[model samples]
Target chain A: MEKSSVLTVLSALAHDTRLDVFRLLVRAGPEGMTAGSLAATLDIRSNTLSNNLVILSAAGLVRSAREGRAIRYFARMEQMRDLLGFLMEDCCGGQPELCQPVLDQITCPC
Target chain B: MEKSSVLTVLSALAHDTRLDVFRLLVRAGPEGMTAGSLAATLDIRSNTLSNNLVILSAAGLVRSAREGRAIRYFARMEQMRDLLGFLMEDCCGGQPELCQPVLDQITCPC
Candidate 1:
């Protein structure tokens, strides 16, 4: 990803509410969750949730699909992956050992 | 890492100049680069570099140590690891396969 894209993703996630929302959506899985559910679960106002979702969508971190009368939002795992890749792009500078621990931490044992 | 720390780190890196500076520091590795050199290399004014460095330092993303009359800044790899771990903490939610691609991209082949 380009620097500007990375910046956008980072800025989008920098907020406490947005990060929590993104994590919640990630845990919710492919089926995703509705704005109402997210607002209730996060104990946030609808307008606040709406604003955060807009920022996340704009950054490509979240996507919405209209399902019935509700819009379901799913975490865009690919975008998260891209942001992580950009963050670590210059890591270790060809020395794998330097960043091995970081890699180890990110990898799921399961 | 706490949510606040992640926010701080994310906000610190959200800017183009700061991200560029951090990446430069990362590539410079443990030995680090002096403030004077960073200013020259990034073509940023000393005040601007100083402000950016302060933000990076406050976020614990970079560390500076006095070297002669100058300060040399180095990327804090451990902190970067913490930030990445926090980001991926909820990823895949026990379904490692879902996040395997992200892991693959971040791991250095070298």
Candidate 2:
């Protein structure tokens, strides 16, 4: 992925509220969450949540789908994987072991 | 890890020079590189690199040690691990599968 694109993703998640939103959506799995539900869960104003979601969407970190009358947002795992690949590639070219610790910690049973 | 700390690290890496510095240090391994060497490699000025290094250091993304008159910087993999752990915990509680694709891609032979 492009460095600018990676930067955008990083910047998008740098905020406290957006990071919370992204994690919550990730945990929500493919079911996602409607804007109203997300606002209620995070206890933020709809305008604040909307602003963050727009930034997240612009960064390709989150995507939304319309179901009935509400739009639900889902985390874009592919973009995150791409971000990790870009960072890992930096070390893999020289010392793949440099990323061994990080890769090990991120390994999940599921 | 604290959400604020995570945000700090993410913000530190959101910049072009700082991210370059961190990734280069990661690839450089424990030996790391001096500010001058890093500046030369990235083709930026000493002051620019120094400013970025300060932020990375403050964010616990990198550490510096004096070597003679110069100092070398190393990427703090532990902090990266913590960041990953915090993010993983987000999904592990509800859907560990959310992070599976990312983990699968990052799995290395080493």
Candidate 3:
């Protein structure tokens, strides 16, 4: 990923609301959740949620699909990988010991 | 890590100069690099670099030590793990396939 795109993803996740939104979506799994459900779960106003959803979608952290009358959002796991890869690229300059611990722990319990 | 600290780290890295500095330090490995060398490497002014370093340090992304007349900075690899862990905690809701690809790829080529 490009630097600007990395920055955009970082900026999008840097916020309290958007971060909550993305994480919640990630936990929600592949079926995902609707904007209404997200706002209610996070307890934020709809317009506020709407604004953050737009920002997250633009940053490529969240993807949405039309379902019936509402739109559902899912975490873009690939973008998450891209962001992590961008940061970890060239990491430690051949010193695997410095970062291998991170890799070992990265395998989630789930 | 707490959400606030996560936000701080995300915000600190969201900038161009600081991201460059941290990645350079990461590539530089445990020996790290001096602010002067970093400024020359990234081609930014000393004060500007100073400002970003302060921010990165405050965010717990970078650590510094006094080396005679110069201060050297190292990327806090553990903090990187903390940030990544926070994001991946409860990730996929028991769906390993959703995040395992990232884990497999996370092992640095080095």
Best by lDDT: 3
Report the C-alpha lDDT of model 1 over B1-110, residue by residue, as the tens digit: 89899999999999999999999887777678899999999999999999999999999999999989999998887777668767776565546566655444444332
Regions of candidate 1 where Cα sits further than 4 Å from its true position: A93-110, B93-110
Q: DockQ for model 2? A: 0.43
Residues A42-64 of candidate 1: C-alpha lDDT, one tens digit per residue: 99999999999999999999999
What is the descending DockQ order?
3, 2, 1
Chain A TM-scores, candidates in order = 0.84, 0.84, 0.85
The lDDT values for all models are: 0.82, 0.81, 0.84
What are the runs in model 3 whose C-alpha is more than 4 Å off?
A94-110, B94-110
Better of 1 and 3 by TM-score: 3
Deviation of model 1 at B87, angstroms: 0.9
Worst 10 residues of 1 chain A by lDDT: A101-110
RMSD of 3: 3.5
- Per-residue lDDT of candidate 2, residues B1-110 (tens digit): 89999999999999988988898887887678999999999999999889999999999988999999999988886777667666666564486566656544444332
Q: Per-residue lDDT for B18-79 in model 3, tens only?
A: 99999999898888999999999999999999999999999998999999999999998777
Docking class of 2: acceptable
In order, the TM-score of chain B in each prediction is 0.84, 0.84, 0.85
